[model samples]
Target: MSYCEDTIKKMLPKAYVRKHVAHEIYVAATHFKNLVPMMDKYVYNDGTTKDLMSLTGTIPVLFNDKTYNIPICLWIEESYPQTAPICYIRPTREMMIVRGKFISSNGEVEMPYLEEWKNGECDLVTLLQVMAVMFGDFPPVCIQPHSEPEQASCWLQFQRQAEVLSKTDGSFYVSLLREDDQPFQQDNETSC
Candidate 1:
């Protein structure tokens, strides 16, 4: 038994109807070797926290003829197969979350597979496979640009300008400036 298996056995002793939750996790590990299971405290949106079993690691996604390892975390509730595991895209320090149709700005994943999860039909392995496919179609994150000292200062200036512009109801300027902070060519005819 691996550490994850042991932890599952120890933490979930109630032996829920889906008594093979640990076994499912073990199978998923065999398929996605990079994923490692651990128990962690997961805080809910309502501010409640629960110690839950989670698998954290990267899943290989082939995009544009190249493979990228997309980091992810899956939180399995105590109910096991009765409920779908909560999933999130956990980008690395060099990456930034790209809010898309299937992913939220905060990195929470929402897809048809999770929304239509059925008790005996949905499993961790299949869930991961689906995520790989969906992510391949629309990546959940992108590599953020490395900022030099000068670039950082420029970004701060843009942020300050955006703040002032936002206060003055310059919604267009606020949106454009906050998007990427890229320097835009000033047109003499254009004024905020």
Candidate 2:
């Protein structure tokens, strides 16, 4: 086992990994040779210090009868499985970070599947698959990454997005805002 593999095994019990395929998820079912989970921490709004591990991967999202690889981050925390991993779109300097009710300007994310996490039942695979399906409604787009330091912040991109969302005929913006208020449904399992 490599360093990441070893770290994962330490984070989660070996017996549990064998039984639940947690190890498989770390490797994305052999699709990825290794998972480079960066050691990080997140302080949530509730004054909680969440120990976070982030890894980038492409999730096949079905949209318009086609599939697209959505570049995203799987932010695993100490309370994973019992709590769903926080998902974030890996934005390039050119990619406009979509700030919706569920998606924050700083790449914080909340999706229905995550809210529906059930201990010992839902794992990373199921959650990712669900996000892939959910993304059909909101297409992902990216631009060329700017080399300038000033344009590197996702917040600047969000400001630009907010401007566009504020313009009249911004029905799209309203929809996203509405979705933020909507509750995550536990029974909504219609992922392709």
Measured by lDDT, the strongest candidate is 1
Candidate 2 lDDT (Cα, 0 to 1): 0.54
What does candidate 2's lDDT look like per residue over 73-104, in tens digits? 88666555566777787654445555665676
Which ten residues in a row are the worst by lDDT in model 1?
183-192
Whole-model lDDT, candidate 1? 0.72
Q: How many clashes does each candidate structure show, in the order listed?
A: 0, 0
TM-score of each: 0.72, 0.56
The TM-score leader among the candidates is 1
Q: What is the Cα-based lDDT of residue 123 in candidate 2? A: 72
TM-score of decoy 2: 0.56
Q: Stretches of candidate 2 above 4 Å error? A: 1-7, 10-24, 27-36, 43-51, 140-192
How far out, in Å, is residue 141 in model 1?
A: 0.6
| lDDT at residue 173 of model 2 (Cα atoms) | 26
